[model samples]
Target: MSTVVAVLGATGGVGQHVCSAFRASGDRVLGIARRPSAAGSALRLDLAEAAPAQLAAALTAHRTEIVVNATGGWVLSAEAMHLAHVQIVERLVAASTLMPDPPRIVHIGTIHEYGPVPAGTLIDESRRPEPQTGYARTKLAGSQALLNATAAGTARGVVLRAVNVCGPGTTSASFLGAVLDRIRDVRPGDRVPMTIADARRDYLDVRDLTDAVVRAARAPESTVGQVINVGRGEAVAMRQLVDWLLAAAGLPPDTIDEQGAAVQSKGGDWTRADNRRAARLLGWQPRTALDASLRDMWHDAARRYSEA
Candidate 1:
């Protein structure tokens, strides 16, 4: 039987991928976003401020069995982050309880929630989250809210703490996305200014992350009420990744005018995931190659820039 899936923040990078993954799997997808597009069954709804009754009605009307909370704010103000991450989650949990058969929630979280890990250490789901920035704190709060609802029997919830996701359609604010923008704006002699190039991060293809979400949504009750780390389980230096991207874009090494010197890494120079739980429970792993993902990002960005 085809599952009815409701994807919140459906227009966002990860949300769009999640919606497409579900539809590709032959499931019915209902995309909910503030500015819903003509993709799938679009529903324009502000989940943060929408009444619980109204939200419940929408889910019930669509017969949604699984709801993916992909809405999040990265560089927004603290107030905006709270609204997007925390308040919206609280509202969703409340609304789900109102349904006769509450929909299972798959909350998309970030590795930032784990804060700074030791250089060689891998973060597991058991590690207590130490969110430092407002973004991380707000996202952690949202994940906690969903888990709490599951514990209270108000909802079935699973939190996937994903690492840096890179692929086509990456947001311009992301590290790789920023690099693509820089490449697009680079003139013959202009030097690209970047930050945190020395830091090592585990990057997962957006498609891999979406595959994990689909698996988590279809997982049994035993997999619910748990937090799983979703990532490639390997770390690559930011500088190396940037160099690869530049090379892929047909830019010469000398073309990079690192203004003065490379950006110094702050604390938490490494971020890698321990995907044992994800593999054991969700039966998933990163299948896309990093080089392939970077190539796709370059092509996608170039296409967008040419069209603009």
Candidate 2:
């Protein structure tokens, strides 16, 4: 049966893509945002300040069947972590459960939950979470909260631990998005400063991640309470990505800047997603390789840069 999907944060980086994917799949999608416009039944909703009753009313009014909690905030700072990552979960838990039959909740999570796994181990659903930073801790907590809400019959939930998802319209404040902008503006003598992590990790196109979410939402109810990692199984080195960006931009190697600077660690461990579980369970697999995804993002970023 076609489902009614309500995408929270429908205008966000991942939410926008997820909303687009749901529309493509013929699901009835209603975009909920704090700044809604005439853009496909937009509603003004500030999840943080919204009461449970308000949420329930919104869902009922919309007749939603699937709730994609695609809204998420990230920061390298503690205060931002609390506001962006933690409070959102609490709000969702309160608001969604108020519904008569709460919709399936697909909460977005970060790869940082698998914080700093051993240099060689592949991170899958089975790996126990070892959170290191405020960001990871809050995200891991949010994942747990969503699961608890599911077990309590408040809502059915799925958690997607996504990696460096990138695309156009991403903010420079983001790790990969900032890199895309920098690469687009590289001159003949610009050496982009980056860390030298010999570690390998997965990357995903935001759209591909959205595709995985669509599949997961359509997944059998039996797959609820599952936390899946979404990424191409292959891991790419940070340096390799830098080189790929340079080549994709059609810039000469002279534009590559290699300063003798130590790469600052983000206070977490390296980990890669074991996507076999997602593939077996939800039939989800990453369609875009990191190289290809990067190339696509470069074109989009370049175009945006030109327009600006």
Candidate 3:
């Protein structure tokens, strides 16, 4: 039976892909976002401030059985970020309670919520979260709400704490997205300048992440309410990733701005994902290799650039 899935923040980078993946799998996907999409798929509701009553009405109207929260921790702004990551989750928990058969929520959390581990440590779900930044702290709070509610038997949901995601529909806020912009912006002679903070991060393709999300939505009650870690299972150097991106895109190398590249990033020096729980729990792994992911990202950027 096809599930009725409502994807919150459906217009955002990861959210759009989540909606597409669910739709491609023959699920009835309702795109819920603040703004209407040009494709006419959005439900056009701001989830960050939506009351429990409003959410219940929407769920009832759509007959939603699975809700994929594809929002949170993407934007770095303060008030809105808190609302998106924390407040919206509280509302989602509340709304689920009003349903006779509460919809299963797949809250997409981030690896940043684990903050920085030691240099060579694998970021398993067992590690106690030490979120460093405001964005991550907020995301952790959101995850805590779901965890708490699920434990109390008040909410039916699972949390997929994902890694650094990159793929098609990536925006300028991301590393590869910024690189794509610089690649498209410069003329033949002008060199693109970037402030590179070289750190090893576990990066997952958006498609890969969304695939796990769809699986999570359909997982058995045994798997529901579990916090599964999802990612590529390995960290790659930022510089190495850039090289692969250029190679995969068949683009010429842009000059790396070496003089100012040696700064510590906010997330910290290094961390990779431990995705064993995801495979065990959801029968999922990141099937898309980084090269293929970067290739797709570049090609998608090219298509959009041409359209623009």
Candidate 4:
């Protein structure tokens, strides 16, 4: 059946692709943003201050079947993390619940919701969340909200806890983008202070992540209350990814070296997602490889930089 899907945060890194993926899958996408854009039929809505009635009015015009809460800031901002998390997810959930025969809600949370796990262990939904940062803490709360919504029969919901998603359009201004830009600009033998060895991060291609969302949103109602991890089941070290990027750019392996940094700078280690549930339940897998995808993203960013 043809579906109408609403995309909150429709202009951010993952949200941009989420919009494209829905359009590609033949879903009519109504994109919502704090600042409206031409990406789709824009809806002006600010989750933070919008009243419950206002939020319901925003969704009343469209008979949406799927609602994707792609809104949320990645880098820590001035706003309280929990407040930001609750505002976006809550607004959408509230709107969906208000609608008669509400649509299936898809909440885009982060893998950080699982907190810091040791390398080599499979990070799955069954594990209890032990959030280390305020961001993760808020995301965990969002996950709970979805579960609560499902249990209360307010709406059918699914929460996707995603990992580090890499793709084009990232700049030095962004978290990973800054590191990538710095590495690309550095000359051979210029050692930069890095915490690559400290953390094992799970990086997913934005394209592949979008595919998982599209699949999960269309899943059966029986799959409600499921918390899924959408990622490539590969636990790649930060140092390894940096090396891979250097190799892709034809830079020598030792061209960039990690300055023996302090404990806090090194950050936490990571593990890959156990996508068995996503595969069986959502029938999804990442199609893009890290090295090639990074190269493509770098070139695209470089082109954009030159154009600017």
Candidate 5:
């Protein structure tokens, strides 16, 4: 009895990995993206622009039991953010109503939606969101939509507000991803220029994050309407992460051009997830060691470089 799952943003950084994980689990997985299908059972339907009827038709066609909203991205514009995070989600809520038995929507939200937490605070599901960035504000709005729908009995879902994600498929759009893009090509003594942000944040392996997504999909109805925090549960210095990456790449600590670094922080920014509820509910916790994550990421980057 395989579950029918549809992953939006199937071709994206995190979405592709989510698709792979679900497929490997022997589920009936449909990879939905705006572009042509490349390697899986993908359907190209831009939910950002599609009507609820359109999305409902696709879900009905696939007999979708779970709809994973992996489509929200890091774009920083009012219209783009609204389309990806708010408008599209509103449509998904409406679309779920149109289903014979509405599917559970596992939305991939951001921990940034918690907005600025105290420098040493651990973020739990109880923190009131005061999202400042356009990305965070829109993502919060999107999560709220699903929550409201779930409360009203019009939808069933879980929102996994994820921390900073790392591991394979790290894109240049992110800080760690930016460093990885340059680290793979650097020799033992070659220098790489980067501006490491002054922040201490929790980082989660993408595979681990996907594992949580799968859990949310399979979780019982009791888990619906819950906003779960998924992460390593500890915030490490951003500069320390860069050091680990360089070490994994077999480069010297001096390989980083520290002169270009952002000004030092005096306990300026931080966030760590209190994953207790997640453990109690989903029986989920990150299993990958941070060092192992960095090492594997380095290997994947080198492998891609070789293939290229």
Candidate 6:
């Protein structure tokens, strides 16, 4: 039987891909977002302010079997982060409890929730979260809310702690996305400023992350209440990754403003994911090559540049 999936933040980067993946697999998709899109049936509502009863009615009316909470904010303000991550999640959990048969919830979480891992340590689901930034802290709170709901049997919840996601149509706020934006707009000799160039971080293709979420949604009830780490399982230096992106965009090696590329943040200095659980539980692994993903991102940026 085809499942009915509702994706919150359906117009966002990862959310859009999740909706597309489910639709491609023949599932009925309802997109809940503040704006309309081609992904699924539109339910225009700001989850942050929407009451539980309103959210419950929307889900029940759509007969949603799975709810993917993909809504998140990258804002620096603590209040905005809390509203987007924590408050919205709290409301979603409440809505799930009101359902006759509460739908499975796949909460998209961030690897940053684990905070700073040691230089060579591989982080798994068991790592103690030490979120430092407002974004990370808020996301952790939301993750705990989902886990708590599952433990109480009010919802079947799975938290997928995903690493940095990059691909075509990535948002400009992301590291790679910022690089793509610069390359598209700057001339060959023009320099672009960046930070944390030496940080070793994991990057997952949006498609790969979407596949894991879809699998988590369909997995057995035993998978419920589980916190899974979904990532590329390998770390690449940010400097090296930026060079790769520049090359993919056909930019010169000196395009980066070396003097301006000093470390501006320590948030991603060293972080890598141990994806054993995702492979074992969801039979998922990243398949897209880094170069291929960067190429797609470059092409997307180029297309947007032309249109601008």
For residue 294, model 5's alpha carbon misses the true position, in angstroms, by 1.4
Question: Which sections of candidate 5 miss by over 4 Å?
Answer: 39-41, 260-268
Q: Give lDDT: candidate 1, residue 230.
A: 95
Better of 3 and 4 by lDDT: 3
The candidate that wins on TM-score is 6
Error at 286, model 2, angstroms: 1.4
Query: Model 3 over residues 14-77: C-alpha lDDT tens digits?
Result: 8888888888889888888888686435588877668998998898888999998887645767
lDDT of 5 at 86: 92
- lDDT for position 282 in model 4: 91
Where is model 3 more than 4 Å wrong at Cα?
A: 187-189, 261-266
TM-score versus the correct structure, for each prediction:
0.94, 0.91, 0.94, 0.91, 0.95, 0.95
Q: Which stretches of candidate 4 lie over 4 Å from their true place?
A: 171-175, 184-197, 263-267
Clash-forming residue pairs, model 4: none
* lDDT digits (tens) for residues 175-283 of candidate 2: 6676676676667666766544555666778888888888888899888988988887766777677667677787765565556555544434355778888899888
RMSD of each: 2.0, 2.2, 1.7, 2.4, 2.3, 1.6
- The candidate with the higher TM-score, 4 or 5, is 5
Across 18-115, the per-residue lDDT of candidate 4 in tens digits comes to 99988988878888878887656378777777875676666667777788888776546536566678756766667667777677888888888777
lDDT score, candidate 3, position 162: 87
RMSD of 1: 2.0
Model 3, residue 139: what's the lDDT? 89
* lDDT score, candidate 5: 0.87
Per-residue lDDT for 246 in model 3?
Answer: 71
Model 5 lDDT per residue over 1-308, tens place: 99889998888888988889988999988988888466464788877779999999999988999999998776756898899999989999999999898999999998888888888899999998898778888889999999999999999989999998889877677777778887776777687766777779899999999999999898988999999999999999988999988889888888988755455321236879999999999999999988788888888888888988
> What is the Å distance of residue 166 in model 6 from its true position?
0.5
